[model samples]
Target: MASEEIQIKTDYITLGQFLKLTNVVESGGMVKLFLSEYPVFVNDSQDQRRGKKLYPGDSISIPEVGTYTVTRENA
Candidate 1:
């Protein structure tokens, strides 16, 4: 799938937080369940850590959800 760009106000964002920021998962509880249910790819590799750090240029793929690329917005 084509990747979507997600701009962040900070230098980095956690995987779970990024999911929430992108409106992928509604809540932390949902993120936990979602992670267990589907595979999340970080820079093209399977990553299960909710605390995984995502910096600019990082890519995340949530299977059928869609892919997203991280970018630091003007801040």
Candidate 2:
């Protein structure tokens, strides 16, 4: 599957923020509901925590949504 790269300037980003950055959900408040309804995978393992930490090089996949790869932005 095609993977979209998400660039982050910080050391880490939460799963909720990742979802927002990718436009997978409309708002931060919707992250919880989205997680409850959909299966999200982090490094190929199921992850459902909104506060889960995601660092550069982490991979996330959500069935029917899309796959994503975290990357650090050049400073």
Positional deviation of residue 9's Cα in model 2 after best superposition, in angstroms: 0.5
Q: Which residue runs does candidate 1 get wrong by more than 4 Å?
A: none
lDDT, model 2, position 16: 96
For model 2, state the Cα shift of residue 42 in Å. Answer: 0.2
lDDT by candidate, in order shown: 0.91, 0.96
Model 1 Cα lDDT, one tens digit per residue, 26-58: 998788888888999999999988999999999
- Local accuracy of candidate 2 as per-residue lDDT tens digits, 1-75: 899999999999999999998999999999999999999999999999999999999999999989999999999
Pairs in steric clash, model 2: none
Question: On a 0 to 100 scale, what is the lDDT of residue 72 in model 1?
Answer: 88
Error in Å for residue 18 of model 2: 0.6
